[model samples]
Target: MFNDDEKPMAPASNAGRPAVGFSDAGKASVKAEHSKEAPLAASTISVLLDVSSSSSTVGRAPLDLVVVLDVSGSMRGPRLEQLKSAMQFVIKKLSPMDRLSIVTFSNKSDRPCALRAMSEAAKSDLKGIIDGLVARGGTNIEAGLETGLHVLADRQFTESRTANVLVMSDGEQNHGDARQVANPHGVPVYSLAFGADADMKLLSDLATNGGTFNPVPDSGNTGMLAVFSQLMAGLLTVIVQDLHLILSKPTSPDDDLDKIIKVAPGDFNQETDAQSGTVTVKFGDLFSGEVRKVVVDLLLVQATGSDYEADMLEVAVSYPDSKGVRQKFRGQTLHITRSGAATSVRATPNLVAENARRQHAQSIGAARELADGDDLEQARDKLVEAQNALEDVLDQANPLVAILRTELQQLLDRMESPELYKAEGKAYALAAELSHARQRFASRGDVEGVRLFATPRMDAYLKQAKEFAENPDAPVPNADEDAEEEAKANPIALVAGSLAFYIRTAVEALQAIEKIVTATAAAGNA
Candidate 1:
């Protein structure tokens, strides 16, 4: 769950774009783990590949844009200039594949502008229309949105691809209802809200249906054109459709740590419900498998949904499910020692719980291998021995036990029954049962508990795991070695060097040309 107060990594005011899954891989030197795998719907996999890889800008859907502007008596001074400027920016930034229509609303206009399709040839015409716009009437924002939708709905943009609607307003609805306009087109209407008097709540809701709510970071200081350009260019970068992940039962067939995971459809934007000191994300239809590493970037928003606040910083989350309620995931606790302080690292409640269930499923698969063994006595003994050797150790740190305690404490805080005590037991019981199903996987030397719960690519994961397993208290890599690694990884130095060389060559060429021209002129004069 993302918090509004968490400053976005890509600031709204920044004209720069966020490096989507590319530069993060250290200058695209690595092959993708998830980017290559096709999501549930193979059609929307455009984002999986690099944007530069394709000759097209096609996304999961093609959006038809209608910039419904509210121009009335109030938008007379700086507001009018900002509004027109914003439209200009939007026109320049709109991708050629996308269609742009301009509509302005005012009480004085005879008929609202009908949506016009944008093209290279039509670009001049759209500019002409914008220039011709007059501001002599009262505000009628609702009417403008209605008109925009009517024009858009007239041409079902969402038939296959997605439909996008952007509404810019500064005041409340003077006429008509924007929400009541049956969006049969499934068009996601995002809004750029302005003016202190406007209903920001409505604008935010409108954007959530797939649109983005972008308030000008600083009012009066922005050119409408500049802001519009930023929004249009920024919107295209979001390619990942479903972000929430679940690991079902991933395993290593060899001694190699394999990352097996699939993606499914779901919406996970900012999780508001997670603010109660418990971050929980509910899963819907999702692709599941074995997961090795999960990295999530949290932007410290300073304070989103508020104006002019700077009290936020980005933080990485790496903690075990703290509120330990019985969960499906039986996660391994990584004892993390950072800053000379040791703390048991655990997965988030949501991820850990889901993973526990996945591990249980893997364990069950192992039981089947145990049953097929030729030596029954050996199989039973091995299974019993493995089960007993770790039973006490596991029971002490059993995820269920910790969860029950936390859940019971929570219930006590609320003055309610600690049902999770029983519930947690059931969750673990189900996991163990799932593991128990694998009766013979152990006997044939084919099973090693639930595959998902275990480390991936046993060799790779084990190699790394053993280093940590054996020297859990050892100091990290030396500063000198780390400095050398940093020197190799730094790309900025290369960029700077290239720019310096290019300037030097340019200067040398200029001097050479000057000498040659002077010599020719001297010869001519003589």
Candidate 2:
């Protein structure tokens, strides 16, 4: 589905029409829709990155990864074993074109392996190092991070690759300033907190600052493996890095535009220049088959006279491709006509739905935070308000609305049960942890049930690979003739294939929380 030949198109010479760059690739298309109203009416213009199946693989980059593991005393038993298995899986999945490094930390940091290309020999050596690791002493996360950063920096200077860090920790930082150490690293850090005791806030902050996701696994080896597999899949399919969108202000004084806000693919960074009316938004990375949507509210004050063209806005996009090639795209002057006729046009349904989904997710997050603070009444009120708001904008048939309704109902049920509300001990702790993990996953715009849903396909691919290796003369698979077929046959071979693992893990954690809550409620009734 990915079209590597699609390029940004220049707008026509016409003055009053909206123009886009890379329209075929769906890179920077602008849609301006206005409500039918009097002279002083508002409109909304959406900027969409349509990374549909037909055009998802614009830029594929080889990965340069650094895996930072925690070998603290807390991770000594099943946690350490799970971590090792996860690392082994990652090593196996990486192609020879990719490079990897390993760093482990307890009271101090140890570099078990330097940046090495992925070969059979390298993988065997890494596996041996992982197998020999023993958990003891305290956690010094800063040392591990620093070592990983150094390894990545060294590799970056020698070769051009998409460098990243995968930090797996199950404890807090007992030495060194992790924030200070990580701030200067050029590579993104994808953190995975292994247990309930892991510092979620710290891991979240680290990943956010590094422009990546932090996923926490549930309390089990299966959960750990699921989260790690998903994270690795995401890392393997990054298409664009350090993507930035710069928007110049509208030229007409009669036009007013609200600050641009991200509606999908999770929030990143936005900056505005008040004097120049310029806005810069930083999108850390764009994966294959990922569509990013941003929305802005616009008001046009028009005079009742002859139709005239007014400049609306201009957008410029810049990012580095997988090969470390700097690519830039610019949009033509966006213009709108002012007329006396009372004609209105509706916005795109999909864009509207996306904005509504973002609002819904944000509301859920706010309500959960309030509940965590023991403000049950406020949390319920927030959820109700969110539901009402969604109903006003989204149709009942919208699947996202249904999901929001279900989540709200679940929260309501939990709040109504006094015994469940006050439940404590391991079950409560696990539920709370999973709840946070689910919220974080939603914030990242990850689809639910992806990991488990993709497992059978992944297994099938592995089985085929084993068969091919044994025979060495199997007919070439014609999977790529259709994107869906190819993904089902070999999920890791496509850009969207890797996301299945992360989504699956998030769904599993949520399911576990539900089971825990249900068991607690039944026991209380007994």
Candidate 3:
């Protein structure tokens, strides 16, 4: 055997197509379709998210791996042996061109033991050092990080590719607490927690800076080794690696949905693969109220042809105001396809109907307690808990139900002060939002699904807004922002307001929502 743990003698030229994200069933379908390729590992997919919206891959290639092994007294047994075996797996998996280094700390301030290099010679030598590893001394968490950085040498990292540190530990950083001092390695570091005695926080902190932290609770060293393997293999397929996203730009939520979506820092990293070719992506993020912009970041993999495609990525964000009022905005699956993997990404944005129904009943009872209680936070707590429980059932994507979930969330935000005009207005707006969401639901035409969706309170506030706004006795609307503050909404006002909103959204989605609402009303009246 020419040393399975020997360093990769040469760098690999990534020359394959990018893979797509799909449902498990869809994935199986594709796998079966491609079963004829005997040499292909179709089951292996490398997924990279473009979280940076720049044209460069952060000026780095991808392999910045630092091995932080634990040789403390407890790890002296077969555990240490298993770790070396796992380390060997990583060595066999990585390319010679990627950066590799090792760090170990025991006792108060012991110097690190490391062999740093970007060549096969360095890795080859490190394998021997790994095999000859001996367990001694107590754990000193601070020293491990300090030595990791000393070996990494910050000044040299600017031109490195895939700069990262992999910290494997079964002990806490108990000796001293200088973790934050030398911890900012200015790159991603993945944490691997081993055994029961490992400190999750220490590993989490180490992985917090531009990296991910993973835990190996058992002695499944093979799985731990595979994590690194998957991460590296995906990196090789990427071309454009930078992306950014922002949602709901331009319009103020002061009551609007005809929003403008903008993508800031929209540039993506440049990328190309042999089979799939080059891929460029647009990244985005969504904000509440009137959407003025959407920002996105992405890692471009490859494409099969010139046809435009889109893949989906979903994001959820929320904030709680001082009065224990919660507000939120949800982004559906992000699509990134253009002769690449975009069209295959799906968003199963389904509402938890079963849970929502259960909560709806409990909420009615809770509403009684809420009205009698002065503690808004306490009241809000129950509401959030219920909503969270309902969110659990979301795995399918249906539009009508989407509206109810959004409405329920908004209702939770306003529950504390149902009498307040602002809260009431929000409720009305939410009702309108639900009305729109319902229209999308009809497109699916599943009776059982529709019945489940209709179970939620349609909260007819928008219908009331319309009647009040059109009242002959009501004064002409004031354009002043303060005027909106003084206005109190009733059923008529809600119906009129709802109509105006319906018109705006109808135009925005190019689907004529107002027409649909009008038709709905007429059919109901008939």
Candidate 4:
């Protein structure tokens, strides 16, 4: 426990590099909670590390994005057309500050469009190039990735700019090993498996650098566009990069330090230092209004002090600001109140943290493996068990619980029937469950499934995209138009503003009628 005179450490700053004001007042906040705050004796303490970014985060960084496309013979007719349409949507969505590069692969690769700012003329040229792309030859995914990674690596500006690669393919690679292609710059390479024939495992392996391998079943232009929109939503609103969380025991005079038993970092990579007994988990980048939860199990020793609180762990979060300067949030202490009586303390669990653990269980690849192995019974049973565990902690009426229930039920449905399991069922189940656990938004298993968990911005853009797809002649809505529509949808404040005026006018009319009646009566009496 911290002494009365002790204060939380201030945010650390680099000495030379200038700190740019990027996010809002609170860039990010970290809080740790225990399932059982007060325990009678030594027990496993479930520590939930809740990390969130500010909703009002400002200073959007410029983007350097590369779209690596596969123009193999397999993607001939509708597949090629859908790919072009998706590329056009991506180009339209980017702002002038953002740069886009295109790479097409068929046995080999070609960079038709280099990294250039998204000006009106540039966008037009890119769209034309996309339309002119012809599908032929075999797939060389390695060459495409190599070209894309090189294009992104050779950037003119580094400060206050974000870079990423998007690889779209629908066929197996007949060329070099894609996994061997090094991502030295650590730019996130998101993969879009276009159709059923696409190798999801290869794509998944390639996306180890802070990216997701999203499976897009052969649905249509809308399906392709939906996935793109979801990816862009996070990429465009990047608030922090190279984020890391360090967990360690609090300092004390006695040799009684808490032990970090285990950690479930969920899709992110983690490293533990043997000498220092500190664990660091790399979260890569965080988007505005995004949440990343890390669960840790600790063995806490009894505190040897007169204070009533026992400090168990200290959590410190660090990330690079837009200017490439390292900024650190003050370390926070998770304390449990010390109790004397054995029966006095009640073990109350933190439902949010507990539910997150349950969600993580579903995403750990067990269900995916079982489903892939054709063990439908075991897979369904695994999902049911996780769902039941979630229900045990949370009520069915809770929105969080409902989301888990819906997800589990959908997976169960897929497992019971062979037809559904084969037709994008397994893909959907894995992607949905993983997205939930990782807190990354993705398309639903059913191609036409409604957007369940997209950011407000992404959801609006998707709605507009669907509207335009329905009728190409209709004018596409802009941000201002979206805001207006939202205001119209909820006009309570507008009505309230005029409510006072209406009441005043009504009262004045009643007073005038009373005066007129009094005047008429007086005149008749006279």
Candidate 5:
């Protein structure tokens, strides 16, 4: 665990908007040791972009959301009540500018509420519909998703908006193929695995194109609420949209065009401009405080004569500002010296960039493949190999590396037995991959590593929600609980604070029970 004093990365001076930074792992040299005629060398470089939230006078973008909720038999009892409580919180958070629709699915799927702006009256009606939901019949996830798409498709596309689909399912699909449902609008689809019976692997696959897959370990109210809170944080904090990153050689006629021959953009959608030879990666939208690392391997050709400087590559980024005007940030030119001397040269690696590269690479997928093939030992060996490399190159004390090493170790522990691997190892692997690949903090609906991107307000709400769910009747600590002298000196102030705390808790607990009672009564009526 990282100490409270430590940070994941150094704070960027450019705090408001996304800023571009560059570093090379090592320099490329032309001459090989002990030989005059040697093949050209290759080098790896990384471009790290800090996507921080801009100071906004206007609030978050207007949201067009569709929630596909599961009403299967498995979701009855506490499971459904917990879900309703979370949904209430969600409805309470949205503004009038945001539009929402609710789609419920079981043996069949239907929309209880059509897409409408979150007016006060509309919110009340939605809450009523949410409380009255009854869980029954088989799970038709395919029908749910298709109906959701139809809802979005039926809406007016005349305006620029941020749209998404939220999928909550606690059981396996028994009706049709959810994977085959096509999303013509290309809206991101965030999924939640509500309980143990959920098909995590399938949900992970569905969220691959865009969006994230969050796991809620069980039907516990706190976990459910935390997942919903995290989802809200992501939806309301998109700072950059239609982000485009372009990579190509310098345009100078004298510059060496042949220096960079290939570019591999891992898992991101890319298009190579044949005429200009520039690779453009489409990173649709970035949330507040998110970090995206673009690492590309470059092959450099060595000059025959003396040492000289050569341009490696240039990176440029573009995104639209709030006023709908395009903004561009051009990265500084990267250069390295080419040496022709017969002596061997050693290149110093940039530990930070290299570590980021390894984390984003194929280790998780490699292990998953081996484990799926029944080669459990090889899967464990693959993780060990990755961990060893990380240890060799990175300082073990670094906060980021320490956290990563700990997670890797946790995965390693699961491979000790086939029974263990079958139970939860695979889920851990998927979570780690999603966390790194998408550069978001994803886990089993726990608060671990959530502070990485969660704003202070959201963080406080999550901690409080978790604490309340764990022990609703627990007393709130006095403001000066640890400072005995201060508490004694300010007895009157302490009494006032305690009174306020109790009042808040009483109201919140009453509200929770009210929702539960309403749902229970509705179920009994059916």
Candidate 6:
């Protein structure tokens, strides 16, 4: 799980570098053990491709948004009010260039308003429509989605604009086929599962088609607003769209592109042309400061008595800028050398640590599933296995190891305390879900905010920690002398402060790693 204090990678100070970068586990140099009689040798190479946006401010694209609200019987009081507040917040953030549509569903779907530009008059009219919303009947998610799609499709496309649907629901879909409703239509459907009863699987399926799924926990109206605001931030800052990576076939006759693994932006659709020996991967939209990473594996076979340099693979990237202008990056080559030398260089520590983190995430996910099934012991064992694996590759000198170790220990503690685990099980589950989401799609900064909102208690502690850090001389609260004494004995304050310290340390370590990588790359070029 990501800590509250762990900040995302800051933009590189240098501006000449491309936003996207490619690296590997190590230089693809393999020492061959072939003798006079040996005919062939085999080895595998791993490549990591990272795509990031520069920190510079860019023009904002106009948005065509469809707000789908579920006014079901379950959402009668505070839930309905919170939903209304969230919608209004979104409205305030939109500019005149953006167009908005409102769709409400409860056994049936109703489009209260069509796509209208965010003029003062339009905002007033939408607020009136939102204020009149009432909760009743069943949940017709299909109707909500279909109506949203209709609104979006009806709009005429303008230059440099993006469109999508935001579905906010607090219950299970009682009618209609949500899957059929979410067919490919160029526009993605971002779904928010409001409250515990919201059908996560249904919303996940809807968003998986082309968008993201967020679970809005029942943590009152404030939490609702936070989640909505975070989503809006992502929508408003999209810097690149329709990003595609094409991997051409290797030039070496003896080598083959074995596999392509998407290590980040969790759920992406990829297609391959068997005849052309080419692979195409589609990454939807990238917000500024977001990074998308992927790894490709290649298998190389060398004929006997041959020492040669082989072009392992070529990667070409294409995407549209915020202005809808197409930009292409002509492919770069990854070379591998087969040598008779006695030694081969080891993989870089950063690459090794990244791979370990990926594996750890997978392990944590598997353990969560087992725990959900009431197999706590097995879950602990799985996590223990993961911890051991991480320890094998991570040395004491690496600061990340300590951070990771602390996270694992905290999770293990949760599992061991039955009372604590039962009380905070949902929060724990959500933390895992959010962690996986960040690993797959959300930007690092986005994940930090979302995770804080989703876990109320943690958020409170983190906030308190920040306050304390900013004003160390401020007096601690106390109701009376006894209360003041109790406050002094309280572990919560200490834990919160410690968490803040750890988070700062972890973030600094990550920044140091980035600097090291930059320096190493420059040295290699020199």
Candidate 1 regions exceeding 4 Å error are 1-62, 108-117, 156-160, 217-223, 238-526
The local distance difference test score of each candidate is 0.36, 0.55, 0.39, 0.67, 0.62, 0.58
In order of appearance, the predictions have TM-scores of: 0.39, 0.68, 0.42, 0.79, 0.74, 0.68
Clash tally for model 4: 0
Which ten-residue region of model 4 has the weakest summed lDDT? 1-10
Q: Best candidate, lDDT-wise?
A: 4
lDDT of 2 at 289: 42
Per-residue lDDT of model 4, residues 296-403, tens digit only: 877766644342445677787787755578876545656666554433333235545355555544553577788788877787777777766775664445566666
> Per-residue error at 476 for model 2, in Å?
17
Model 5 agreement with the true structure over 136-194: per-residue lDDT tens digits: 99999999988887777767541445678888898899998999998876788888887
TM-score of 3: 0.42
lDDT of 2 by residue, 24-74 (tens): 223222233333333324444454333212123222445677888999999
Give stretches of model 3 more than 4 Å off. Answer: 1-62, 108-115, 153-157, 183-185, 219-223, 226-242, 246-526
- Per-residue lDDT tens digits for candidate 1, residues 1-526, read 1011111121121112222221111110101121122111111111111101111111212235667777776667777766765565455434334456676777722233333334445556776677666666766666766666666666533332234567777666666666665666555565655654555456545653434454442254343443354344324322222222222221211111111122221233233332222222222111111121232212211111312211111111121111212223221111111111212223343344333433433433343234333333343343344334333333445564343333223222221112421222222222233222211000000112122222111222223223433453443232122222333565343233224434544774575466569768979999
The candidate 2 region of ten consecutive residues with least summed lDDT is 1-10
lDDT of 3 by residue, 43-73 (tens): 1112222231111111113355567677787
Would you list the clashing residue pairs of candidate 2? Answer: 1-54, 8-22, 230-502, 451-500, 451-504
User: Which ranges in model 6 have alpha carbons more than 4 Å from their true place?
Assistant: 1-41, 158-160, 250-266, 301-310, 321-327, 336-338, 342-345, 393-526
Q: Kindly give the number of clashing pairs for every candidate.
A: 38, 5, 81, 0, 0, 2
Clashes of 6: 2
Report the number of the highest-TM-score candidate.
4
RMSD of each: 27.0, 16.3, 25.6, 16.1, 19.1, 13.7
Off by over 4 Å in 4: 1-25, 251-257, 303-307, 342-364, 416-419, 444-453, 471-526
Model 1 superposed RMSD (Cα): 27.0
